[model samples]
Target: MGWLKMPLREGVAALQNSIVSELQRNWPALVTLTPDLLGLEYPGETTLDFLEAIRDLTDSGMVTCEAIIISSNDGPRMVDAALTARGRAMFEPKGRAAA
Candidate 1:
């Protein structure tokens, strides 16, 4: 059987979409980024990849990183993330009344 493959851009897009969807569902609440949690969400992605994606989103002002959790050894561990106004505007569907 031939192996199925996705282009790099498409894979990245899917990851981004998953992140946006999670944030949309947890709107107004910060989502903690842990390796295990990320793994559960995007099984194919590595922790470093997720971090890079989060960094890209932050750079674009699509999301905000509240805090960077560090280990006692002074290494970065996880990040606390939340969607920004711009992110919400882009991800949230239009013409929906706020409950």
Candidate 2:
């Protein structure tokens, strides 16, 4: 896929979007997704990239995620993820009140 060849900036953006969309698809449920799971979706990204994207989304308040340290080599990685209020707002149709 073209995403596999996308530049770092575009790829990271796509990763972040994918993260949010996955949570959105599941809605109110907290989903546990390891790096391996994410890798299946974006074969182009490294584990580090997925960790960074999770941090970015969490820092931005778009999503609430928990980072689990698998080992020294793995460092801190996000596992459980769910959209925050801000994140849910992104999917809301224009002119509709947020639930």
Candidate 3:
């Protein structure tokens, strides 16, 4: 399925995976979510949809967004976002100490 066309759970999972991957690549640095980083055009998705996906990550103790600004034109702007240890674990190879 397309990025935004997936079921809500799967879409959120995909979004989380993307966020984790980018954060993992940068390691010690944080990210500010941009359209380029997000890399998807959620045509039918709303700001709440974006926020809900992000909320899922934060609620699961996976990642953190220091500043989440709701843009009137855009959606949510996730500033200074970073993965937690748990989020990093998602990228670990199988059999590695991911927990």
Instruction: State model 1's lDDT.
Output: 0.65
Clashing pairs in 2: none
Number of backbone-clashing residue pairs for each candidate, in the order shown: 0, 0, 0
How much lDDT does candidate 2 score? 0.68
Please report how far candidate 1 places residue 20 from its true position, in Å.
1.2
Comparing 2 and 3 on lDDT, the stronger one: 3
Instruction: Report model 2's TM-score to 2 decimal places.
Output: 0.67
Pairs that collide, model 3: none
Arranged by lDDT with the best first, the candidates are 3, 2, 1
How do the residues 1-99 of candidate 1 rate in per-residue lDDT, one tens digit apiece?
865543344355666777888777888777876545544433334544665666667767898876766453433444568888888877778887433
Output the better candidate (1/2) by TM-score.
2
Give the per-residue lDDT of model 3 (tens digit) for 15-98: 767777787778688888754467766444644456777777787788887888776576567899888887777667678775
**Top candidate by TM-score:** 3
Each candidate's lDDT (Cα)?
A: 0.65, 0.68, 0.71
Model 1, TM vs. native: 0.65
